[model samples]
Target: MMNTDDVVIHVKEMLERASRPITEECCIYRVPLLIRQLNQEAYTPKIVSIGPYHHNSLHLQNMERHKVMYLKSFLERTNTSMESWIHYIASKEPLIRHCYSDALQFTPNKLVEIISVDSGFILELFWTSNYGTDDMYLSLPWFATTIFCDLLLLENQLPFFVLHDLFCLSVANFGNNDIPPFILLTFGYFQSLNESICLLIQCHHDLRSLTNFYLCGENKTTHGEEPMATNSSVNKWSEAGIKFAITKAMNTGKDVDILVRDGIMENLLGDSDAAAERTKRLCRNIVLSDFQF
Candidate 1:
């Protein structure tokens, strides 16, 4: 049997032999098998796939043509050629692939194709949702909400830089007297999903923090805050007519007092009661990992 240090050396050497890099830029991740097994539908995309992870899933295919249609509209409206964008994306091949935790099996060209169209669709979404549109997808409230939910999923994301670069690239094309920062536009996209929910983040002011709430979905547990009840316990409490309400202060981190939050309900769509249970269960049987922002 190998001794402790020998075993450690062996593991290190094996990692070196592997092609995967130390992904410091790695933020996007596939939902772990254990976590995905919790409630598959909550994490999986139903309406649209934004990134390479679920790029051509069969059920998600129907939205493909719509993405292309949105891309076409974006190009025509901006009169921006795809050639420059393609070159820009192609040059970032390694960095883009590194953003996801796993190695991307896609070819360089295929990866660029996926990012270009998907990012274009998202930028167009930010535009139409704010600027006004008669587009069929944006018009249907339910479908629009589903699309917004998918955008927030862990696996369904392009790197933030890719999105920021494209947003800046298309800014002048919009011919705006004043264009909001990309971070604000992103929050505005989330706000548009539910007119009832207002993301009053203007005063918070850090670009990084503003994007963290939605982009990464990293619910940072505070020093004293945590789950006092298990999944079954939370469900039982709700069943006993113990209604959970928003904290009067409405501050950060998990407020254990309110077991189910609108933030959770919005991301995991379902029947009201069912949504609450599912949201509470998200923390059950899961240990927080150090590998986060």
Candidate 2:
């Protein structure tokens, strides 16, 4: 409906805007509809929502009190003032917001508050789970199990750096040197899920990124000539004179290397419930990466 002059002016404005520097790339993403549709509950958080994406949902409101309780305990144990915590997280607001894929509509103060409370709760929860009294919340039947599973959900994650910053500050304040590394605590917490999948998380920024190490592996390249895609199961492969031998070392470093030496396929397999799911998802991702899904 506009004239040529108006269109030209609008195009020029758009081009100018596009030329500005992009401050952040999207890191968080919604689970693809295809994946979500397959298992609606798996991707959904049952107990808590950690970031702006799923913050303050009606069903998740019960956990809000728990978060506050944990925060209070954290403050008491660390003996650190709340004002200092706020200032530290407030300084990292822009960087933290950039971790999410979408623009957070909350005010800067609200965003800082969310990050501070959530990160504090998580750090405290981890510490308590490892070293607290036997009467803590984790002692509830199936409570720890459900919460650990919820934490691993994509939508129920806080940026790992936020957690690390708070943890370091707390440790510095309390002069406590006994806390284990975050990755080790996390792996220990969820070890029941997959003991065989050795997680070597280095320089990861979030739980989702850490989990990807298990699902997709470190390397993308196929080890040798790509196996021909055929309608063959492991049993069928065995019938075709292919022998399957389980590898002893199930390291993340060798996750994607499928070896075929002398008609033997040295495949990797895990023996836990979580490992079974990871194996299926890993194969699906590998095929999808090859443009075959």
lDDT of 2 by residue, 226-293 (tens): 65343334344445554432222222323223223323332344333344345444333223234211
Candidate topping TM-score: 2
Per-residue lDDT over 191-260 for candidate 1, one digit per residue giving the tens place of the 0 to 100 score: 6443434343432222222334322322433566654332234344445554443222112223332444
lDDT of each: 0.68, 0.64
Candidate 2 regions off by >4 Å?
A: 1-25, 134-137, 200-202, 215-231, 234-293
TM-score of 1: 0.69
Query: What pairs collide in candidate 2?
Result: none
Name the candidate that leads on lDDT. Answer: 1
Report the C-alpha displacement of residue 271, candidate 2, in angstroms. 17
What's the true lDDT of residue 69 in model 1? Answer: 82
Q: Which residue window of length 10 is worst by lDDT in model 2?
A: 247-256
